[model samples]
Target: MWYFLMSDAFTFGAFLISYGTIRFSVNHWADPNQVFNAFPFAGHANLPLAFVSLMTFILIFSSVTMVLAVHEGHKMNRKGVEKYMILTIIGGLAFLGCQAWEWTHMITGDHTVLVDGVLQTMGTTVTNNPWGVAADPGAITAALQKTPDANLAAIVHSLGHGGTADAHATLGRDQMISTIQAANLHVTTPGPIAFGGYFFGITGFHGFHVFSGVVINVIMYLKTKFGHFDQRGHYEMIEKAGLYWHFVDLVWVFVFLCFYLV
Candidate 1:
């Protein structure tokens, strides 16, 4: 396990180093603050890094529980090991849930951008970056001129208007276009295409590690429940599993720093 972890560390290190190189080479990269400034169930609230911080906390706490489980294993305390292992599994599952929501939010988000002298709505994806540099006032005005009435109305509705969908549907095209112009909604030029690739590749890789760790913990929990460790006269398996869990947590600290903080 130690050898495997060492090799894994080098892989992650190389990925991060390459990401940093590309990021610095670019004239404009997406701002983490603007990109991650969202919270679940909080409409349009700019809470940057809030959800990610919660995920970090949960993973770290799970590492603590894994340590406790290992300590108990040293003393052949089956019940203690079982309890801590269960907690660790729960934490891993919670982190996965949070990640799923974040991915869904990013992929499904409605962002307006100026493309080919016309305004179009898009979302973040491997080939698209919705969180690019904001378009200038002149560009926005020109794009608005070319924008279709239905697209204009969709943009206006995305700006959090209080009208019901039925009522909005009844409104005329001119009214919708006027509403959009009055609101002065900002659009962006697409960011570096590599940004989405790196973000998803690295974070998705880390999420897989977390998921693997959760599965290992679940198996460990079942083994403890069946008195497998007690029958063996030692709990080395639990200790080894704990080592893997801790390594997963440590890697996340760097992942969070690279993708979210730096």
Candidate 2:
């Protein structure tokens, strides 16, 4: 049971990660600021919904508290166990609120913006659009097949033949953005199937983790409220909860690094 549930979760998160990678590889992709944001007043500020980043650190620290909780629970120090466990639940809840607010903002597309006498996109969907002299996915697939070693030269030739799919020419880059805008909502963006597939696929997977952890922590919180954990022996339940929480935070570290840092 654990294997199946966890394997599915892990696979989904990893796939979404790969999807994000392929999306960014597009020529002069959109920035995250224009794509997503915090609540109204905070939006004017340059904050990155960075609460999520702080949550990651809080979760890691909570794991340390969990270790203390477990140690105290084993020694039958009911007060210490309760104290740390309650604190851990609060941390998890704070993280959940951050994620919920983030989603509330993310699902809505970024409205169009006019800049420098040209339209430039800001949302993730921009990465998915394809318009104007679009590259043939089938041909791109064939090129991938034709490549000798998946090296730069082979890929460059593939893109060049298809008219600069890779980033290089500045004017062409602008045109491609305009093209994707024109192609917006009508066709999938250029490149292989993996490109569009991964964009939505990977992040959805990670979001699922955050969701599940919230549910589990809520359950733990209830049991604590009912005194289900105290005087009942070890707090392995909380320990296991902490393990999953830490794993979620650790993955976000990578997600933030790979998706945003670049």
Best by TM-score: 1
lDDT of 1 at 201: 91
Model 2: residues >4 Å from true position, as ranges? 1-13, 33-40, 48-52, 113-203, 224-232
C-alpha lDDT of all candidate models, in order: 0.87, 0.52
TM-scores for all candidates?
0.94, 0.55
How many clashes show up per model?
Answer: 0, 2
lDDT at 144 for candidate 2?
33
State the lDDT of candidate 1 residue by residue for 1-262, as single tens digits.
Answer: 8999999999989999999999999999988888888899998999999999999999999999999999999999999999999999999999999999998888877788888888877778889888778898798887787887666666766778776434665687677667777877768888899998998998898899999889999999999999999999999999899988998899899989988997
lDDT of 2 by residue, 135-161 (tens): 344543333333223132222322223
